[model samples]
Each structure stands twice: as C-alpha cells, then as structure tokens.
Target: MSATPAYRRGMADKDFDFLHGRWRLRTRKLRDVMDPTCTDWIEFDSVSEIVPAFGGAGNVELTSLATEPPQEALTVRLYDAGEDLWRVWYLSTRAPGYMGPADEGRFADGRGTFVCEEELGGRLGLVRHQWTRLDTGRPRWEQAFSFDGGESWETNYVTEHEPLGE
Candidate 1:
C-alpha cells in the first residue's frame, strides 16, 4: 500500500468554504505595476458571488464592477485533497483572450500564499498572491510582483472582501 503525502494528512476539504457567498469588494490597483515610480492607484467598489463546486473541493467566483464601461471577471479555485494544494486561475474582461497563469499553494496558519511566474514588461517575473486575515473575520488579498526571484517585491493590487447579508 502507498503512503499518503505528508501535506495531505490533515488537510480538509473545507479549506475554501468561507468563500461560498456574496461579498462587497473594495479594490485597488497600481496604474503601472511594472514601473517603480508609478505610485498612482485606482480604487473601485464591486460585487462578487462565489459558488461551491465539485462537492466542496472547488469554487467559482464571479465579480462585477460598474466602471466606465462596466467590467467583470471570473476566478476558479480547485483544491487537490491528495496533493494538499490549491490551484487558482483567473480571467478578466480587462484582459481579453488568455487566462492568467495558474497559482499553486496551500494554506498555512490560516494564510495562503500562492506563486506563479508570468511575463511582465516583456520579461519573465514572479507574481505572488497573498491571502491573509482570513480567520480574523476580515479577509483580504494582495498581489505583488518581483523580478529578482522574490528577493524584492512590489504590491500592485489589493482587494478587501466584505461579506454581505444573504
């Protein structure tokens, strides 16, 4: 018989259950994520709905923003119980055509940090997604990018999720 992976030993399927609901989103993003001196930011309010799928092992999040032309996005998250990891994929109307790179990670101490590499300004760079304050009843997410293999990073986006009454 094969032994189970150590990371999977105690991991549960309810890891993402907290996301199954509607939320009001306070979002901010840097105007130029790759430019060091571009401190300008755009902030907006939006709404989101997360639906559970795959019998609790996966979820789909749909977001809508009433921007100038109206905007929408979708995020898909899947947890691999046997691998003890979660993978996320995102697509935004702001960027048509291709879905962004996949981010893979597992929760630790009520926080989840996922990482992936993607092209930025014509060069490959590392992108990090952070999930924190999860258990504190105030969940937030941040995104950062690093060109030096994580030796340095600059936060480019943040979203504070406020749960709305059903």
Candidate 2:
C-alpha cells in the first residue's frame, strides 16, 4: 500500500469533502433557541447546497428554511492547516448583518464537534454544533447551548442531511 496523503493523514483541506453536494435538510428546532425549558418545537423542510471552496481548504453551506416569510442561512467552514482545526461561521437572513463568532474544533472518528460563546437575548452562553456520521448516506448535524459555562447543554436544533438524487 502507498503512503497516505498529507491532507488525509492530518487535519487538512479534505476534512469536509464528504459534504460537497446538494442536500435536503429536514430541520427540527425549538421555538426559543435559548430556553432550555422551552418544549415548543417547530419542524420544517429546507434545501441546502454545499460547495467546496479554496481548493478544499474550506466549504460553504447555504440553506433556505421553508418557514413563514422564508428565511435563509449560510455556514462557512474553514480549515486551519497550522492549527489542525476547523472554524465554522454562520450568517442568516433571520438576523440582519450578522456573521459570527466561529466554533472551532477538529473531526475525530467520523465526528466533529465545535464550540463557541454566543450572546442570546442579552445572555452570554456557550453554543455547540456537532457533525456526525458524515461518511454515511445520511449525515446529521445538531446544535446545543449551555448557560452554565458548559456545565450543561440543551439541544435545540437538529438536522439530517439526505443527499439529493443519490
């Protein structure tokens, strides 16, 4: 067998290669994203497109949530070769002129978990986004928040990506 390529051997450009394509996102989220006690939930169908950019050093996901008034969201994932980690930034039509504090982490054993601090409703807390089963036909993404400095986490958002025309 030949030696493994550098990008495949360590954290490099190909980390997000599996996500490049079109996807159908079935999303379920809490009505109040910051409220751990909130049980009210909303489900919707969204379409997403992921394109590999910067020669696979990064990727971008554009999602259109089919909710009332029709909203759109964008996620940009960039890999830091030197740091051997990835940083994800998010932007949304739901929030005007906001692109955020990136969640940073590296993928291990087919799972990727990233965390960042965010202020929701005048309260600063920890936000986490996880990507799992990415090598499968159906990959999953989930979001959670913790108010007590990562002591606890409440999952508020989840989406399973079904490959389009697979």
Candidate 3:
C-alpha cells in the first residue's frame, strides 16, 4: 500500500484555507415572501476568526440590517477533516424555531459554493451561496435556492464585498 499524496493529505491545505481573514457577505432569502423583491441586496461586513477550541473553526460576525442594536450573534463554521468540507450552523432570532445547516463546496478555480439543506417552518428548503473573488481585492456573494429537487433556482441576494481599508 502507498501513503496518501501531499495534495490530498486531508484538510491541511485545501480550499478551506481561502476562508481565512475577513469577508463581506450578501445574504438572500429565496423562498420567503419578503424575498424575490425586497431585501435582495444588503450590505454588511463580516470578520472570520480562527478558533483553536473547535479545531480552527471559522467564527463569523456581521451587522444586522433589521436590528437597531448594531451586530448579531456569532455564526459558526467548522472544517471537518473527515469529509474535507466546511460545515456551518447558526441560530436565527428572526426565525422562531429550527436551525440552519450549510454544507460548503470549494472549487480549485478560486470559487466557492455553499448549500444549506434543512427544515424551515415545517417545509423543506435549499439555500445556496455562490462566491467568487474578483481582481480588485473584492469578492462577490450571491444567494439562490431550489425548492424542486435542483431543477430550478431563484436569485435572492447579490452583494459585492470590498476589503476593508486599514
């Protein structure tokens, strides 16, 4: 038997490394009534810090648009060595019950995609985030969802993230 290759040596130097530092996210709701028209593109800045407690998890925080207090709670993301993927979980005060679980897929071409498949309001919904880094030190985040078995997709949110000046 042969040993594992250097490139495929678990989650050491994979696409997960691109998630380090800070980012600006554009969140969209594709399946809701308020979505598809309103609140499509909201601007917010986010910072992702590596936590040693959870095996270098990506803990994120951003300002909330609906609230007046300023910022929201920390959304958690973990890099699983077993699956070689990033898993995200977060609790929303906007939604009364249930939780959000998102599975992330990163491409070698400097693009990333995340899909959230979980129950919301007793119904099945799938939300996805498409991200790409541009030449101007800015990244783009787009939100889309499929309700019918990946047959169709609806655009909900689209926002560009510009790097914060020091």
Question: Model 1 Cα displacement at 118 (Å)?
Answer: 0.6
* Superposition error at 13 for model 1 (Å): 2.6
lDDT digits (tens) for residues 97-162 of candidate 2:
988799998787878899999897799989999989887878899999988999988999999899
- lDDT of every predicted structure (CA atoms): 0.86, 0.87, 0.54
Candidate 3: where are CA atoms >4 Å away? 1-6, 10-19, 22-59, 62-73, 96-98, 120-122, 134-136
| Residue pair clashes in candidate 1 | none
Candidate 2 achieves a global lDDT of: 0.87
lDDT per residue as tens, model 3, 13-94? 3444444445544443333433445543434444433223344434454334432334454556665555555666655556
| lDDT tens per residue, model 1, 76-165 | 999876567788999988888889889988777888899999998999999999989877655899999999999999999999999999
Worst 10-residue lDDT window for candidate 1 reads 1-10
lDDT ranking, high to low: 2, 1, 3
Candidate 1: residue 139 Cα off by (Å): 0.5
Model 2: what TM-score?
Answer: 0.90
